[model samples]
Target: MGEIIYLRDQHFAEFHDKCFLLLSASNHIELSRQLTKTLHHMLVTKNTPVALYHYLPTGQLRLIYYFSFGSNIEYEDEISSIRSFEALSHSQLTYYALNGEHETWGYVAHPPSSYIGSTHWISSLVDIAMHQLGLLSAKCIDRQQAKLKTSRRLLSKDIHLFTNIEEILDRHRQRWRDIFHACGICLASQGALHRFGHCPSDHQLLQQLSWLSNDAEQTDVIEFEGSHQGSLAVKLSLAGTHHGWLLLFRDQPFTNKHVDSAIHRALSCWLTYEARMARVLADDLALTIAALEISHTNRQFITTAQQLASLKPAIHSAPRAVTSAEQNNK
Candidate 1:
């Protein structure tokens, strides 16, 4: 709809040995699949090795497509190494957010000399694809935000009606697990904070929790490097209402900033549930005390009534002088 954006001529140097094209698209799975198909077709025609990398903003990077034209030993080794390690490290490809909304998809390839012209054509095609993908990304992000908003509202409503602290903690754990799964991360452990109950015995987690208790507002994410390869703790607090921490561990160290908004929403729900449970527990205790007091008061009243009835005859004579002489005197 607007001016078509293209990579500048000078930027071609970066694509000399290998080419990279970043598509600001959120439908990564479909787009990657389509690109793979197109590249496979190109491979069939040009007979070269091509690789497409699809990186989602949620920290998932996959080699969605790969094609090899011939059996060059060196090239095969390179492809094998890239497959094993590229996604694990940031050396081969660079990933950054696009306008803080879209993910950057990277493509790299080693084309044969015979396919130079075809490579140029593919680059031009990708330039046009990037623009279209950008538009699609914006729409996808909007839809995702709407869904997240709806989920938050429902969680908030449910949280306010919660009466058990355990339920709140369980929900918190499930939320962290879900978030980790969505981000393609493996979660080791997660739970609500407690002074002496059910908290992880790991020193790192305890230290993080101590720091969070000291100043919950200053920090949102804490990192731990210890027995666990990568441990992260997010501070969860609601002023005087509730205070807690969420711990997540993974095999590799990574930042949680990508899902910060989701974490905050989850923490809000947990805080609401915790506060409601505290009030419910307090109400239950008060009711129990009141019932005990009422029961004790009723027992005392019954005992006093019985004692008065026992002394009733001594306190008042009932028709004691009802003889004929007594009646004449009266």
Candidate 2:
């Protein structure tokens, strides 16, 4: 019987003119009805396409909820033609997991353009919004889990840890190689670093990331050409103050379609899990220190714990509306 919580007033402002609401409630038909009822007023006022993303509780979090409204010309034409499909015009509701089990509820819609050459900006905005909401929901769950000692789970299951920094870098390198192979893309060459200092290859591209500033948590996609033409460089800043970058290269460029969205979604999920894992690791370290009768005031132990604490995942304090200016730039 967990309580349902809605996003704050600031988040509502971020929704802009479009109707958007994010809430956390238990997974049940009754709760879904409650959500539908809540959005009823919006639906009547503007029959824009509605999307709901339901996130179930994991070992890390408690409640999950997502709702959005926008107009998609392509989806309107497609769904409206379906006979007897009675929901608000071009509306859909989806239920999915933050970590596992991929499922979309209600009528699904695509980006409002052909998937081939178009930028699909409208759909991309919706997708990114949903992704951000999902991440935020997971952060909420992690916060709740932190309050219960018995609920803490192992972070190693989600994040791979090494004894040293070098090992971590090597592991990331190997992971990129694996991802390229699995995605049917060849990896020409790749490198990862903390601050994009100096790199032999892709120096200019890596340097571009510097402009994003240390506080930018969003993913940046860069297209490059060299031995492997049409390659894409996906770079993301890990959660927390442990300044590190994950750079991956693929032989093919990602479209603004399903493929690109899927990759980013997967990466986002991994980072969320990694953030939770960091918390678990920090807890374990503290417990170990105590078990060994080490003084809590020990500088080394305190420093290590503080470092881990700083690595906690970045959760969006408020929702962000994708503006037309930003879309044009992209």
Candidate 3:
């Protein structure tokens, strides 16, 4: 702490601000190696391992940079789940929020245990300075992406993705299955689980358990937070004559509105299938009743024909026609 403390530090601030302003105010979305390495060295003096983890609102971690050639992908993976949900490291090696209020961008880079409470203020100061500037960079990137997506959509000839209703439903069903390991959709009407898709080899066990896990009593959406806020689940009904829950599970909370919109759309798709099935079944039942009625009428006609034939035989035995020629002969 005492080393960096000085009356005038024009040299350090000038060097640090050069990289900071370049990264935060640049038109390019991609981070160059040179700028990042310079910036890392400026603030992160840790000869110890450090990694910059960019967290998505979906609760996924993307590695931005790793320093000191100490930690590799394995180390990053080990702590990814913890970073996704936990606000603090296990060691409590101070992490800067970098605008935790908006969840715009926050990273964790724990130094050596020696720096736990010592001289870490400089690192925290760097993060605080990066906050306002990072927001600007994030907004610019978002706008650029929005325009690209809009352009792609406009250039496409068709908006509808699938040719048939079943295709669309199947796509959604597959998405449901991917929400978690061996994820699936189950029917509430069936006492036994009726899994729709994403069946792993061991999914049979999951199928048996899905029926029991449905505690969704209300029609509105319900959120369940998992241990240490590391996992999140949102439950809503795919309701109709036979209602079932549409659920999503993620490593982090489902705070993204876009994700919520997609979930609701899936629920709507399921509801549409339910309504269509009801209509189809009613149509089939009507056709079945008509067929049975026709068969019954045909049976009655055959019985009447047989009765008429029997009467013809009785007439032949009981009566004879008188002729005028026979009367003249008498």
Candidate 4:
């Protein structure tokens, strides 16, 4: 028997009080940490360990946060990587999948028989917490973006997050033009690449860009060299292929310590917007399918009309009975 935290029921005042802790979190990590603690406190049974995972585009879940009450599980030794869940489920754990339609993530657990809160209640609270985190993420990015914009020394942080792809790119091209006092910048993500300046986007972008697409749990902005000419790039990435890059040209040397930080903050908002657009594109694909169906039906009608027109010539060529008055006149 492992050491167990004190059990708490769903309907108690302490439950909501504890749940309110999730709302006060300032960032993703803090919010998730509170979540794990909340889960641990609710369950009465020892060895009823719970691990949180984020779903990736490659159909694997990456472990983000894990909570246990003195369980000796080997997998919990490290809190990283995209290990297969095949071996995990063999332990007879109950996986409560979250973000159902979006395929984001879920929690897997080995709850004992004497668990305090009902599984349904736990699941609902977990989902609500995740939803709260989403809202918190938006607010955090907004506040940070505003704060960082003022910190920029030279150029204006006038970029706007919009739904339309082209418009957003246009705004970025205009705003990020003077990232470092005439040092041009380029933004790329989601199958589209555009370079705003003459900086060498080929070799540097091709080599280091792959690192951001990995399954590692992203928590910080990845910054690295663009080229040997003192150029640099700031990367903002989330789960799976949801990532973007901001490359600055070597036009002007930047000495500001927080230049990358501002870009990082803005890029977070950009990635969030792009991810939302990816979901919107699904709806767009359905509309396209509907349009294609209509086009196919129209083509069929046109083909039938063409066939009727061709047959009309054959009918006209064939001898037809003339009117009696016409025959008499002939």
Q: Point to the candidate with the largest TM-score.
A: 4
Instruction: Return whichever of 1 and 2 wins on TM-score.
Output: 1
Clashes of 2: 3
lDDT of 4 at 238: 31
Clashes of 4: 0
Model 1 lDDT, residue 71, Cα: 41
lDDT of each: 0.41, 0.34, 0.38, 0.49
Best by lDDT: 4
Instruction: Sort the predicted structures by lDDT, highest score first.
Output: 4, 1, 3, 2
Tens-digit per-residue lDDT, 31-66, candidate 1: 544444455454444445454544433343334344
Q: List pairs with backbone clashes in candidate 3.
A: none
For model 3, the stretches where C-alpha displacement exceeds 4 angstroms are 1-14, 17-46, 55-64, 70-81, 84-87, 113-129, 132-330
10 residues in a row with least lDDT, candidate 1: 264-273
Task: Report the lDDT of model 3 for residue 107.
Answer: 57
Q: What is the C-alpha RMSD of each candidate to the true structure, in Å?
A: 15.2, 24.7, 15.8, 16.7
TM-score of each prediction: 0.39, 0.24, 0.35, 0.40
- Tens digits of per-residue lDDT for model 4 on 145-178? 5533543321222222233335544644544443
Steric clashes per prediction = 0, 3, 0, 0
lDDT of 1 at 209: 56
lDDT of model number 2: 0.34
Q: Tens digit of lDDT per residue, candidate 3, span 106-193?
A: 4545444343223443454445345444655566545544543443343232223433223333434443333223234432222333
